[model samples]
Target chain A: MSEDKREMFDEQDDGKVKESRRDFLKKIGVAAAATAAVPAATAKAVSIAETLQSHFELMSDEQKQKAIARLEKRYSEQFGKQTTVANTPAPDGVLFGYALNISKCIGCRRCVEACVRENNQSRDPKIQWIRVLRMNRGNLTFDPKHLNEGKPSSDPLGNYGIQSGGHADKAVGISGEAEHYYNPEQVPEENAFYFPVQCQQCEDPACTRACPVRATYRDPNGIVVIDYNWCIGCRMCQLACPYWARRFNWSEPVLPNEDMNPKTHYLGNRPRMVGVMEKCTFCLQRVRDGRYPACVEACPVGARKFGNLLDPESEVRKVLATKQVFRFKEDFNTEPKFFYYMD
Target chain B: MAEEQMVSVGRRKGQDEVIADKRVFLKRAAAALGVVAAAGLTGTAVIQSARKVGGTNARARCAEEDVRQQQIMVGKQLLLMTEGEKQQMLDRILSSHSRKVS
Candidate 1:
């Protein structure tokens, strides 16, 4: 062959060799994937369908039904009981609001216990959505004797009535020294009052805004909900939450089969997996069903109140209109639906 | 010319055999794929039916129990209240808040 002909033949040979090598590698990759999938398919621990499921919000009506059906089946098998994962949407012309009578609260943690049981929260690791702070009464009051104490003697500002005693300059309502783990012989401890804190279900929720995946969001009824499956476990929502409302599952949730609440909502109290974040959804499962939350019913003194804010006669609206109601961290401009009132 | 003809015939025979082998492999692969697809469909149908039966029964039981629980809670609340409180409580319970809009 001529010089040009020989070069062309050599190039053609190289091209064929490269194509064969590429095809060989592609076949090996396919075989390896199939082999790996066989074990996953047979084990039945995590279904392939579940891993490939789309985001809850992006799914169509038919897709949602199928997803719910899949979840219901999986939960039933795993918990050894028939579990209903309700996909109840928010009711129209209704905005859910909560009001708690702090004065009536006797420091009993029955609400906390009821919440854990009703929500199917992890028992062993003990993830509590509600934290009851026992604040000192002294911190809430200003001693008249100290009215003259903080005054600067012979100052140019001329007695601005700056006080020091009895947490004069400190944040008065909720003190930083409030005890969360107080286990007294009996509740309603003298000189102390209880303040139960949970998800405020804010109008402008910082946690939802901080979520990178849009996993957490505020529903139409003003309740903030998290799609646990879509959560990347980045803990951005946890850090962004001003009320410290969110809880993260660090390890595999240790819930006893008997203790698991079978009545669950898809976004609410359904059993969660490890690494996802969960918090008080205001008992959306029960509330959407026209029933009160477990915490609301469990309160012995009837301190906690739940009702539609849009309705003028609802208990929450009544509390707002009649009582001295305040939101925790109101300065944050979060516009929380939860109100704390003094009866 | 005779030897060249013999070699050409041998090469054609080899090519024919190779084509036949490829056809056999393709037939086997297609049969395996069909079997897998059928099994998957049947298995899925069986699992879905089982889930439906169990879910329906459990849902009925839960609904009945839930209604009973709500009545009990309402009754208890009424019993603990005075006459005026009972009137107010009843009014509130019968309000839009207790009604399921969805």
Candidate 2:
């Protein structure tokens, strides 16, 4: 019996040892499998992470969601506020008109500088919005003094009788045999006038009509405007303009880091993107808000007159009706809003 | 002879119970180790991914801010006063006082 008992205990112990060994092997097997799976899972997670960090333009839809979520959380934390930015359409019903006083205008180029800053024009050294065309009144032969009455005349063209067609209605001179001494000191004389030229803002603007894609059009206020986003840089409008007012952004406008205008209107003088056509919007932003155009407001000489042409009480209308206004290239019938007048 | 009989009976009955207990203990240890390892690995992956996403988002926000800054500068610089901007630079000079036209 004793021998049998000892044998039974030995048998039980051997069985237990066998089962424990099997359990140990199984546990090790499970651990090894888990270790193998970890690396693959880690690699997958890393690749997904890399995709989320890619640029917004390159992100796929799934990645984009991840990216946007991250951005939203970050922005909220950084700004401590929530804000969404969107593009809004420009306001309507703004008309612009400008008149230059040839009689009072001196040949100073101050209007040029003021216009540059006001319009946020390209800083191209050659880009000037206002061009001072100096010519002699009597001498149509492009005499600088006859046109530039602002300065003392070395060779005043007034002596030549070039502007004097001798017609009594349009004529201003001592028409007899007496020598009319052309005085350089005296201004507002029939002998001298200076004209500054810019976009005509014509009623029948040829530029708008010539655009193939309708990228350019006359706004409700009669101001000609160009949509840069729609423009294909065909340069057709530039050729159609009689005044040579439109300019193409040959390259992206090279603006200084500090010189970009953010409050941009599509039609107004915004910092246009590359390969687009741009022209004066007649300071539409200001005009729509019941303010004078930028160029008009900058002229210290008060030479520029601006107001609604339709409003009888407006200064522009009054000046057009009473003053002896003459439109440039009237024969073409552009009916330009801009005009020149003597003091 | 009697002793041998008792030993065989005892071994037969206890063998199955001891084997079962030993197997259960070993299995429980292995399962606990696996659960802990998986949890650690997954948690680490999640943290790494979140960090990468956050960094990219910060860079994009910086670029947008740069654009806004540029626009503000241009607008302020180009703001010409209405009265001064008019084509009256010369007009003001000539009209400073009434001039006698010859």
Candidate 3:
């Protein structure tokens, strides 16, 4: 070959060699970076597994056991105690129901305190599942004549036509305006009656129906429950609930290790994370073990009663048979298992 | 003049060959990257499905009879008494209390 041609071929070969070296260096750089990230990726594997885990109801027996074990370990380490998360299914031939005698309640809020202690509710944000509302004794009335008495008078001379100083009529039964934070030195105030509200455990729950993800559902024992992990934090169930029973965790739940109840149920009063909806499970953790709910046991007056509605001899059945009972918002036809009675 | 023209043509041909080689390299690199990404995603999806437990229908099991009875009780309002009956019962209790006080 001519000398110039040989020089041209050598220059092209040099360029090719330089380009191959640059490509090799780029590959080495990527491999080193990936190697450096291995430890962090490994550390996050457990959390990743948890996030990808299936819904609790969809798990088989073995998967459920594995999931429960994982939760127990995590909770035990978190709370500094031996936490046991029970997955007790609904017992056969039993339908749970609740009854409360409005006359017997004193508006003391003992049940509210007891529920917080038992449920491991967030303390810093102060979430309570039970809300006790104070209402006047004759607040509920069917008479239509008294309705117009509360309206403002159109007359210029107020006293001669209608009273100006008098307040509006108390809402016809339980309503949003009822005093939820009344403190008058002591409870059972004169002419005032207490109405404690919690999850009604409805047979046809609108909350369950509104749940797009099917995370909350009614169990065989007539209790509504939520799968915390499966919940998408859409707040649809909270909006659907008429009783204002559901509580949402806006911030990270602050549960002191000392105050944490080590015993928990998968669907009941387990410690929940931020951005999840929680509500009363009728103390299913205790009830499924054949024990009275913490609220029922804590009440000074025996106003709260819980039992299987199927059994003829149960306390709830007896109350249903004889008492003058009424379900809240009966017009909605949600078929709540909870009944309020007058003695 | 002809030799100068030939030299210029040769340099242009060399530049074209280099550009074509770079294009082929880029195409092969892109295809390799795409294959790797597809494999990673498919593997992740397979692992997730394998880890998940099956049978969503089993969780929906509930006692139908108890639910029926509850519906019946609610429909009949068996636990509730009429306003007149409640008043009468309260009056009877008060009268009994008054008699005992006397």
In the predicted model 3, the residue pairs found to clash are none
Using Cα atoms, each model's DockQ against the true complex is 0.03, 0.02, 0.05
Q: Rank the candidates by TM-score, best first.
A: 3, 1, 2
lDDT for model 2 comes to 0.55
Model number with the top DockQ: 3
Q: Give candidate 1's whole-model lDDT.
A: 0.71
DockQ of 3: 0.05
Per-prediction tally of clashes: 0, 32, 0
lDDT of 2 at B9: 67
Query: Each model's TM-score?
Result: 0.64, 0.48, 0.66
Candidate 1, position A234, lDDT: 97
Q: For each of the candidates, what fraction of the native contacts does it recover?
A: 0.00, 0.01, 0.05
Task: Categorize the docking of model 1.
Answer: incorrect
Can you tell me which runs of candidate 1 are displaced by over 4 Å? A1-45, A141-174, B1-102
RMSD of 1: 15.0
lDDT by residue (A1-343, candidate 1, tens digit) is 3644754765586568558755765565455555444534543555667768888989999988998899899989989999999998888877888989887999789999999999999874667888887765533322233333443222122221222322455422222345676899998888677778889888778999999999999777878999988899998997788777788776557799999899899989999986789999999999998999999999999999999977889998787666655566655767677877665
